[model samples]
Target: MARKKASPEDKIIDAALKLALAQGWRDLALADIAAEAKIGLPELAHIFHSKADILAAFERRIDAEVLAAAETEGIESESPRDRLFDVLMLRFDALGPRKPALKRIALDLAGDPMGALSLIRPALQSLGWMLEAAGIDSSGLRGAIRVRGLALVWAAAFRVWLNDGEDQARTMAELDKRLRQAEEWKDALSRLRTRKTDDAAA
Candidate 1:
């Protein structure tokens, strides 16, 4: 029995993560990652142009994992909110082992507004996948609104998760609470819109 070899992209991302964890991303260089990954500079460069590219790839990897898990677990029977909860919880599970590095990245980005801003597109992309995994439509104006709202909710819950300690009980509680609030608001807005429609009809 032998361990399977990691792909070149995986190797580069792993090395970047390891280096980022050991020595913050700000101080990490492509040369260091190439060395850690045991690949030549050309090989590493072919896979990733910069640390940001590696990080983006890492985010996409996590999104793929969460989406795959959702398909395997089968969310067909669950309510929309429950499906979302399960999908997001699966995301945490995928990220569990990399918590330290993620936390460090979060902290570092907090001090760099531009860096944090750069993540907005990726964050929205991830939320779109999350919604789709939950059997929600992420299309059109309504879909855009849902994506933005969930992004905000997830961001707030993520902060709770970063400090959630080993058990993750707080993270679960916070996510549930936030989702509940969002659901309630959605219901209220629905009713309001219905009343407005009725008035317009009258």
Candidate 2:
């Protein structure tokens, strides 16, 4: 069936997110949201009917925006070494408080990794693009090696972002450090491949 028009439920979601950003996720109520949204309780209930429904809508709303923003950014000043960081920059911007919907989605990721993986695909695809753009053609290399190398870099970046306890300054430093290490590994492998090619010719 064709989707119904936007309703007061959406307004309540927007209001809740605005309040959550203004305050924090820990405090928000249906009545407060209704007031903020300027919608009557019954009208909001007719669409959402419960707090959970509103929150779900809010998260979905956030996730879509974050993805769209990343899509718009595409990539920037990118190298194979720093592509993931650019992706992170775009995502973090989208994750700001005013975008409470995305905040909810992020909070949910800790408990729901399958969902998180779905959310993570854009970053992965961005990394893949970086690899291709940098002329690292997997088809020209050993398939297993290419896959494993990319997987390692991606996994390390994801883990650091998820669990690093350092302050933001140190964290960005670490991100840069990790990118350098990934580039170093790629360089080393290329040198080894060149040596092997010379050996084969000899």
lDDT tens string, model 2, 67-166?
A: 5665666655546456556554444344444434544544545576564455344443444444443344545446345545665655555445544443
Cα deviation of 95 in candidate 2 (Å)? 2.9
For residue 40, model 2's alpha carbon misses the true position, in angstroms, by: 20
Alpha carbon lDDT of residue 3, candidate 1? 94
Which residue pairs come into collision in candidate 1? none
Model 1 C-alpha lDDT per residue in residues 77-163, reported as the tens digit of each score: 467888898889899999999989988888777887887777788788889999999999999999999999999789988999988
Model 1 spans with C-alpha error above 4 angstroms:
none
* Model 2 global lDDT (CA atoms, 0 to 1): 0.58
By summed lDDT, the worst window of 10 consecutive residues in model 2 runs over 91-100
Which pairs clash in model 2?
A: none
* Cα-based lDDT for every prediction: 0.88, 0.58
